[model samples]
Target: MTTAPTPSRADALIREHRENMTISSWASDAVDELGRLQAAERTLQRLGYQDRGGQEWAPPIGQAPDFDLIDSLRSRIAELEASKNARIHKLEMQALDLASENSILKRQEQAELEVRKPLPLPLPLSDDDRLRLRSDVARAIWDVMREHEDRCGHALEDVEPKHQVWDCADAAIRAMKDKP
Candidate 1:
């Protein structure tokens, strides 16, 4: 006898399972698309694009050269150059002033030297004159030493005796005359 074909539940179950899987996959894709759209909206808001009425914001990436940094650097360099030039000008003015003062001092020194010419030495002198000159020399030396001590706070020992002796004697003679 011919057997009737077995009724199979497997085909119906597989069709239902496939339909549910398809529906679940479509739902997942929709959620992912919604999430991407929300993320894009947030990014646009942060970039102030939303303030422009939800318009798409497309900034040029690596399409144009940025000169903002270059401009800042140029500004800084200009400021430094200006400052350096100003300082150089000030130093130059000071140097000129110093030069003028130095010349003035030199002229004054020369004039004073000319005015205070030393006494001419004689061919021969008496013993009394020699002794008087020696005493004068000693007094001059002591005066120079005193002046140096007052001006620089230096002791007589700090100066060479030979070098200071004449200066001291001259100073002493001048002091004596001033004591009118």
Candidate 2:
């Protein structure tokens, strides 16, 4: 008087039961994970972690106040950098000044060398002309010596011969140049 279900129907029912058990197992795992996550969130909140403006959870500040030290160190580093830059600028200026001084010294040395350089004579004189010039210079010197002796009432030969020759030669050359 009882009816037996077909084998296909039994297989389908078994499959449906297995599916339900899998879903239940998954739901249990999800619940456990949810509880663990909630506990972790509570612990984080107690440790100063917070959700600022309903956004993502922000990191907690540590137990110690190290931010102040970090800020001071950053400012100190900035000051040191500024000091280094100023020193570099000063060194650069000193180098420029030294370069300028070196350039001026080089120019002065060149000018000194120029002054010491010998000048070329415009025209070459023959031997006869040289002899005549010497004679004229001697005559001029004798005249100057006589004039000095007459004016000072002393012999010009009292001066050293070397000294007398230079002074007399200069005057004689000037006199010759002045002649037309």
Candidate 3:
């Protein structure tokens, strides 16, 4: 005997609404399709698809593009810059102290001093270099969303729940940021 057919996205949503339940969470296909829709909206938004026609649409916690990667890289870059600035500040303070002594030898020493930070073996790549290496990987995530949009529809006006889409996407991003 043949098993019952899997529920379609439309059918699952309709049934859930009619039955006052949430089959979208339980049904695998429905969940996957919803994810795809959300991803498409996110991708389009990232690509800067604004609705001049006053249309609204967006994605939930869909595909993770370069956002996480770029954010992490930026955070690391900021930390490094702060640390480097602190080191520079120390050097400046030392220089100021030496200048106050009015000693020729101290002046000469300060001029000759070199702040050489330790370079690890195979020295770690500069932030720009590291970002360059990882950026392509992050950008590739958009293709997955694009594929979904092709199957569904790219424009937000074409999709349902247009107004709620952006809110969902914001919530998803907030949730991601909240996580360690």
Candidate 4:
């Protein structure tokens, strides 16, 4: 046996807003993380660059320790720059993908919203107009059925002539039903 899950207030909001915010949230987080990484990389690159054109540490060796340290720092800075560029490129690609996905979600959300425009309020049907419409509907149904029986060699599905008025009312209802 399993316990039933509890209902939450999020259901109504989800129905209206859907999950579009989730995608934007992920994109925002990615951009923020990339920004922080790039800032750190910039700081490290500056510090390493500051050591350039400096002669320090008096030594009597073939290759001075200061020069070796400078070379190492240069290589480290290069590696850091390369990594930063690669990550920036990755973030750019992610942004493009996210933009495309967000666009598609926006279209889908719009389609999901049943924005019903109030139909031009059905004009009031006066008694004379109603009678005329009823007669017209009855005549139209009778003529169509007679033509089907004569030309198509088949009787109308339920035209027994006993429920003529009822059939006309049904046909009128069907014809005047709401359209999408």
* Candidate 1 residue 33 C-alpha distance from true site, Å: 35
Ranking by TM-score: 2, 1, 4, 3
Tell me each candidate's TM-score. 0.34, 0.38, 0.27, 0.31
**Model 4 vs. true fold: TM:** 0.31
User: Clashes in candidate 3: how many?
Assistant: 0
lDDT of each: 0.71, 0.73, 0.59, 0.65
What lDDT score goes with residue 25 in model 1? 100
- Assess the local accuracy of residue 153 in candidate 4 as a C-alpha lDDT between 0 and 100: 49
Writing each residue's lDDT as its tens digit, candidate 2 over 63-162 gives 7346679799999999999999999999999999999999999999999899644333224667776556655565556666777666355444464556
> In candidate 3, which residue ranges exceed 4 Å CA deviation?
1-39, 47-65, 103-180
> Candidate 1 on 58-102: residue-level lDDT in tens?
554443444687789999999999999999999999999999999
Cand. 1 TM to true fold = 0.34
Kindly list the per-residue Cα lDDT of model 4 for residues 68-159, writing each as its tens digit. 78899999999999999999999999999999999999988886673323233245767777666666666666666677666354344444
Candidate 2's C-alpha runs over 4 A off are 1-65, 122-159, 163-180
Report the Cα RMSD per candidate.
14.1, 15.5, 46.0, 38.9
Q: Pick out the ten consecutive residues of candidate 2 with the lowest summed lDDT.
A: 115-124
Clashing pairs in 4: none
Clashing pairs in 2: none
